[model samples]
Target: MLWEALGAARDLGRVHDIAAVLIRYGFGDLVQRLGMARALERAGKVLHLRGQDDIARLEPAARVRRALEELGPTFVKLGQILATRADLFPPDWIAEFGKLQDAAPAVPFEAIRAQLAEDLGDLPENIFAELDTTPLAAASLAQVHRARLADGTPVALKVRRPGIRPVIEADLRLLARLAEIVEAEAPDLRRYRPREVVRQFAHSLRRELDFSAEGRNAERIAASFADQPEIVVPRIHWQWSGERLNVQDFIEGVPGRAVAALPEGFDRRLLARRGARAVLKMVLEDGFFHADPHQGNVFYLPDNRLAFIDFGMVGRLPEARRYEVAELLHGLVDRDGGLVTQVLLGWSDAAEADSESLRADIDRFVDEYHGVPLKQLDFGAMLGDVVGILREHGLALPPDLALMIKAFITLEGLGRQLDPDFDIAGEAAPYLREVILAHHAPDAIAKRGWRGLVSVADLLAGLPHDLARLLRIARRGSLKLEVDVPPLKAFGDQLDRAASRLTMGIVTAALIVGSSIALTVNRSDSVSLIGLLGFVGAMLGGLWVLVSVWRGGR
Candidate 1:
């Protein structure tokens, strides 16, 4: 791992300008804090340094922009995620991170050609009537070019940059190792386990590298929206695709935001509503959603349909979990503390939690915030608080759940950007209500009952064999029993021991009382032998009780 980090550091030397800018902005401090100072120092000399006061003098957003542009794509991507994670970074950092673009210097034409030929057989001319030499855009991982098939069908060809795969793999391994170290050393960061985050990152990056996966994702989404004419997904040229190269029908449309910025006659409001509806349908009805719904990934088709471009990041919610999510959202909207708590606990796998204490915490959260409207509530803040509480109580959300939350937030933000009046809750209400009702409706109930009856019948059909086995066991005068002894047995044993001691304590008190009474009644009598015996017995019993109690406590 150290060798890999050293290699990465050496690679950074090639981008000296970026390194210089990073140090000049105050991002160096973050690197130092993360224990990468040695790498930075080895990469290149710090040509400039920005002190805290200097950072204060500049706009936070400007400083961050400089730092991201200087740090390159990996950190830029990390910053973008941090921007969404209001629970992790400050608002200013989030804002700045959001502005970090994925733009990078284009690879040489020869390099592009070599990768294309390696991925897709011969040169562009062999497969296409014509291929543009100039790339339309260059990004961190790949660049896209305009091309046309022999049949004159226009398409966009995305080719991976030369030698990027190894770099990405190496960096990911380093990041995963670092995450393990952070998890081991820092309790607070354990909330967002670095290893898990790296795993997610690796999954995403791997999918991004394989054009086939993105193609399939696009196909699935396209099929889901086939009934909706307002949404369009581009066709993938599967015959020309490979792990490192993707060819798809080129979409010719203005970017979503650019379309929104048009004159009043454009009906931006309608566009926003349609887009929100499409995304919500994908999430609620289909249970699959595009994780990245930013404006860049969206385009406005000439026919007023929404064109979705990238499918690199997508999320799938299992049917059962989707139902749970629906219930959770409904509970939130209804401000039902008991229901929310029940759903949360059902979702959790914590076995050591004190149910009573958890219930109290839930009650407090709901009582404090349930009355607030969804629009008025700060979901980011609420989620942060909930996560903190869950962590304190030894509960953690599964990675998929966290990713789903991030996707929802991204989609919600995109919708709001398109239309300020957009309300995800309002848009989701009709669909969720129907789902909830169908789940509990009489017809559904009848279906469930019929299913249950069928299962019971099957069990009954097998009952004869079970009965024969039982009879055989009875005849043999032996039966095997399997039981999981209650885990509380240890506590119960301690309680039993305490009870025995208590009984001894009562006997001791009784003896002492008898001795006192005898002494008082027979004062000045001959020997008072019974009183002496009672007193001795009482003292011995009391001492025994005390010793037992002490031992039990230890």
Candidate 2:
């Protein structure tokens, strides 16, 4: 079905590959339902539907992870994106998704040299004083190499893998179509919001594909921290940067993953606190933050300073969302269950849920930490429990908030890795307080009031035209009113059933009377045979009436 609807011959090959991978992962039934198997078979792509017992024995989450790994870079990126959707998936699923590393075998320098030369506007040897042929790191989308400018400024050359755009774009097209098909055909999977998730992923991935966007992100974050010396964002060199290439000052420091390599003088506790504070400020105060703060994206410099790199994926919160987050944190800290419930309900997009049950759960969650000190509270655990409550009620957070929550959790985990006694809530307390105070400040209140007044003025200004249009439509007898009253509809259904039973009973009675008269007045063989048939039909109708009456208890 989707193959015909998609109508792209170029995607058929990708579909075959996806179907083969899914079938190998014991998801053949899904492929069948999605019509991939039939479509591919029709297109002459043979798929092996058996011999996956080894992989099929693993747990569902692990199997999915393995399948994603086998499916290539685009699916791995999808799995990585799914890791941030804790509100939509359980812990097991999220854990499996989190395990999806972007690591890939390095594409040899020679393969990418032509593209690099084009983006750099010169040969690498001509522009850089020293350029390493071997990549420092390789990922699904790009690889990094150490280089130095002609002026001896050490920088990192982030180069997009040659011919990656077409591959990724093709995958995105298939994913969008699959999401549509899933939403339309799979009722049970609708809660996952496949279409919405795909839309968000496409936007993020497209932005990530453009190295210039990542450069812009780095500059913005560096500007935000220009005054702070502790938080280091690499300086983006734009002269040689473009959609396919990013050149930035490379910080030489202890990689975050190499915790054992920390120098003896490094202050782990202070580092943890500083990290927490920086991220909290980014999310709460700045309304923009790096979405992926995993170990590989971070480095610890001497003097306990932190360097954050790789701004390919970032999150943004609008002013309203930031305020809502503050309110949520405020409610949790103050043990205000009502406020917490209100904010959570505002964030969820579920059409229907048990509100009273959700509120009760929130109240219980709040009471669990009623008197807990700020320093003793675990912000990560608290957020996890909140996500659990949302999941229980079949609610999912908006994509932006989901990314923010994932960042928060990752930050807390990184903090704990560095310092066993790290307290995220303690680090977040001051920022939350500032946000709450700002919300109530006189100027802020007056500004909101002024906006409200302006909105009302605009509505009042447009009321007369609306009334005139309505009056004109009414004069033309074109006005229509539609009402949906549940009780009335139910009553109407009952009346319809009663009328149908009454008509059936009347027809049965007429048949019985007519058959009896024919049997009594006509003794001829033909007439008698017709009367007997009528009698049998009347008996069958009577039985039907009796069954209906019994079933309906009428």
lDDT of 1 by residue, 1-554 (tens): 13344454544543444435556676665444444544454444554455567666788677876666665565566565555544345456666777888788888777778778877778777989988888999988789999999998999998888777766665566567668667655666665566776787787777876778998999999999888888989899888787788899998877866754654445555776788778767777788888778778888765566889889778777766777777877776676767766776775555666767877887788678856777665443455555556655766566556556666666666666666766777777877776677678898789889999999999999999999999999899898777644436546777898899989999999989988888888776543788898899999999999887774453
Instruction: Residues 1-554, candidate 2: write the lDDT tens digits.
Output: 66786586888877888888888889988887777877886787788777466887899999999999988888898999888887778999989998898999999999999999999898999999999999999999999999999899999999999989888888898889889788766666787788999999999999999999999999998899989899999998988999999999988998889976798989999899988988998999999999999998899998889999999999999877888998998788888999988888889856577788999999999899977887777888888889888988888888999889889988988999998878887778789889888888999999999999999999999999999999999999999999866457657877998888888888888888988999899899988888888888888888988887774562
The residue pairs that clash in candidate 2, if any, are none
Superposed Cα deviation of residue 70, candidate 1 (Å):
3.7
Question: CA lDDT of 63 in candidate 1?
Answer: 81
Quote each prediction's TM-score: 0.66, 0.84
Count of clashing residue pairs in every prediction:
0, 0
Q: Compare the candidates by lDDT and give the number of the best one.
A: 2
